[model samples]
Each structure stands twice: as C-alpha cells, then as structure tokens.
Target: MADRLSQVSGHLTNSYGRGLLAGEVAIITGMCWRSWSGIGRSAALLFAKEGAKVVVSDLDEKKAQIVVDEIKAAGGDAIAVGGDVGADDFPQKVVDAATKKYGKINHIVNNAGFTFDRMLHTTPDDAWDVIQKIHVRAPFRLIRAAAPHMRFKVRRENRSVINVSSISGLHGNVGQANYATAKAAVVGLTKTVAKEWGGFGVRANTVAFGFVKTRLTQAKEEGASIEINGKKVALGIPGAKDDPNAQYPHIPLNRGASPDEAAAGILFLASPLASFVTGHTLEVTGGQGI
Candidate 1:
C-alpha cells in the first residue's frame, strides 16, 4: 500500500509541476507592495511555479524585486521591472525588459490599476483621466509596443494577452463611474485585439473580477492608501464585510475571492489550456450577477 501511494504521488508531481507553461515567457504588471496581497503578485509567482520565465512589474522596484526573489527561492526564473504603467514611455519599457532578458514574449497580463471612486457629477477631470490611463491606455500601449515581437512572426507561436477588468464594469457600481467606464473599455479593446491578432494566432481576453480580498477591498478606515500622480488616494470600503451587519447574500460563494483564486483565473487565460479561447470575458465573480 505504501509503495502504491508513493508511486501515485510521484507521478502526479512530475506530470503537473513545471509543465503547463514550460518554455513560455510571461510579463505581469502591477505587483503591489508585499504588505498587500494583490492578484498580480499571486499570478507572477504561480506562473513561475508552472515553469514559465516571468517578468514582474510594479510601481515600486523593491516590491517587484521581492516577488522576483520569492520566485527564485522557489526554484523558478523571474526578473523585476519597476515603473509607472500610466507613463507613456513605460509600456514600451516593460516589453523591452521582457524581450531583452527572455528574448521572446509569450504572454502579457495588464493588471496594474486602482479605482478612484466617486459619483459621476462629483468626479474630477484628473480622477477620470488617471483611471483611464492606467486601466485602459496602459494595456493598449503595451500590446502595441509588443507588436513587433508578438505579431508578424516568421514562425507563429502561441501568445496571449489577459486584461484585468472589474465586475463593476459589467454591471455598473455606485461611486465608480470612472472605474466602470475604464473596465468596460477594456472589454472592447480586448475583443478588437482578438479580431486583429487572430490571423497571427495571438489570443486576447479579459478577466472581470468580482470582490477580491486585496488592499483594494480592505476597509478604508484602516488607512491603507496608495499614491498616484503625486497624490494620495485612500483604498478600500468603509464597513466592508467586517461590518457586523454586513452580509453577502448576493454572492453565491458567500465570500470574497482570495488573491490566489483571482490569480488562477488569469493563469488559465494565459496558459495553453485556453489556446482555443479568445475575445472572451471570463467572469471570476463567484456567480455574482448571474
């Protein structure tokens, strides 16, 4: 019995570990500080675990390096590229970092963004502009910058682009006018990419996430904040799920998703498992709004 169990365990490990994305190179953006368990960091680590060389990008070089170090400690290959995604020149920098180090690009995940929640009437021009720049424009620029590497290849390779969206974008949210618009634009952009890049066999998709337990979803009163464009913006809800009277009757799962869970959805879209899938908006919402 012991020998049989050992054989099964060994087979499972060998078959699964370092196989899904072997020989693939991936670039992931928006890996936040270590203190906040963001989905981008989770996806970076998970992709490395699956045998892909990873490029981790974040606003803070030290924070991105932390993720790279973790991947190395786990016997995976990774590098850190820190920059502001909203910067016009930064998207090209990210693509350059990947192509220079790995010599190719197989996957791209545009996951760097933050919400500036406010009613439509009260939302300022800067707030709207920043959100659109980060969530929509950055992804567009990155994809365009990576065109020479990903498109018009002599020998076609399986490539993918996974753009992160929000449930609010699918079914509007209060006080998220700017955020919702940006996310909705992501879906349109992804579909267009799918159509335009299909001839080259490059897949583009969007993952619209529900409530996830990241810094973005924490209690605002906790004082967690992030600086954008030389201004500080508070993060999270006030009561959130911690409120004694709060309940999650809307979500069939009855709870928010973890960063790891959200990352899994991104992984699926980037992996060869979704080779035949493109221009799809995968909703990782725990059945919410369904």
Candidate 2:
C-alpha cells in the first residue's frame, strides 16, 4: 500500500508540471502597485505558470517590473512595459513591447481600471471623467490597437482577449456609479469586438468579478455595506475575513472568490479550451447576482 501511494503521488506531481501554455505569449495590462492580488497581478502570475511568456504593463514602471521579476524568479519568462493606458500612444507601445520580447502576442488581458467611491450626486465632473477614461476609454483603445495585430496573427495563428469587468457593473452598486458605468461599457465593448474580430480567429470576452481581496477593498472601512440591485451586501474589512460581517450570505458558495480563482476563469477564456467562446461575460462571483 505504501509503494502504491508513493507511485500515485509521483504521477500527480509529474502531471502538474507539464505547462498548459508552453509557447504562448500573454500581454497583461494594469499590473501595478495598486494591484494587490487583483486581476492584474493574478493574471500575470497565472499566465507565467501556464508557461506563457508574459508582458506586464502598468502606469508604474516599478510595479510592472516587480511582477516581471517575480515571474523570472519562478523560472518563467516575462517582461514589463510602463505607460498610461489612457494615453493615445500607450496601446501601441504595449503591443510593440510584447512583440519585440516574445516575437508574437497570443493573448491580451485588459485589466487596468480604478474605482472612486462617491455618490453620483457628490461625484465631481472631473472625477467621473477620469474614472470613465481609465476604465472604459483605455480598454477600448487598447483592444482597438491590439486587434489588428491579433487579427494578423490569427490569419496565421490564433489569439484571445480577456476584459475584466465587475459585479458592480452588472448589478449597479451605490456610491460607485462611475465604476459601474465604466464596467458596463466594457461588457458592451467586449461583445462588439468579439463580433467584429470573430472572422479573424480572435475571441473577446469579459470576466465580471464579485468581492475580492484587493487594495480597492482595503480602502473601505470594516463592516461596510454596498447596495447591489437594491439588495444590501456587507463588505468585509481587508485582511479580516474572520469578521462575521464579511460573510456573504447570499452567495451560494458561502464565500467570496479569491483573485486566483477569478484569474483561472480569465485564463480559461484566453486558452484554446475556449476557442469557440466569444462575446460572453463569465461572472466569477460564487453565483452572486445570478
């Protein structure tokens, strides 16, 4: 029995080591200091583990380099590009960097976005514009810039795009009108691109995440509630999941999703396993808002 168990463990370990994306190249945006275990950092790490050569892009050069360094330390291939996604030149720079480093870009993850918590009535015009520019305008421009390159590759190869959205966009959260509106625009953008680019062997999709532990959540105080679709959902203080108020009673899974879990979904959509899927929004919220 001991020998049999040993053999089984050995097989499992071997199977786990075979890389899923041995020769692919992935471009991940918004991988900066603000991304504390959220979509940006999680996507970068996950893509590297899958054996893809990763390109980490963010406004902060230091933060983007940190992710690249971590991937290299783990024996994975990666590089970093620093630029503002909202800039007109940023999208082209990201694509050029990825192509120069990896020879080709197989996947793109548009995950650069920020949320400012303020009631619509209290939100300043400048804040609203900035939020939309970062969340909606940036992704739209990046995808537009990357699509031609992806289409060119698709004529000779295949590619995918994974846009990160949020439950707030789907259900409409209070004090987050700016964020919700921007995310909803992402969904529309994803669908439109999927249709426009489908003929080129490229797929586009969105991942709408629920509450996850990240710097955005950290900004909120402990035991705060945000209204979703007219229902109140309590948000836990960052790093304090043990607090009873943090528990999501409406979630069928009885817990919030981890960034890794959400990242897995994005990776799947970007993988060959989801070649037939496009223009779809996959919600990774433990069945919340379903």
lDDT of 2 by residue, 149-200 (tens): 6875332243788889999989999888988999999999999989988888
> Against the unseen true structure, what C-alpha lDDT does each candidate score?
0.88, 0.78
The best candidate in terms of lDDT: 1
Instruction: Record all residue pairs in model 1 with backbone atoms less than 3 Å apart, i.e. clashing.
Output: none
State in Å the error of residue 48, model 1.
Answer: 0.4
RMSD of each: 6.0, 8.5
Q: Tens digits of per-residue lDDT for model 1 on 145-165?
A: 998888865433558999999
TM-score of 2: 0.83
Which segments of candidate 2 are over 4 A away from where they belong? Answer: 1-18, 32-35, 153-156, 222-245
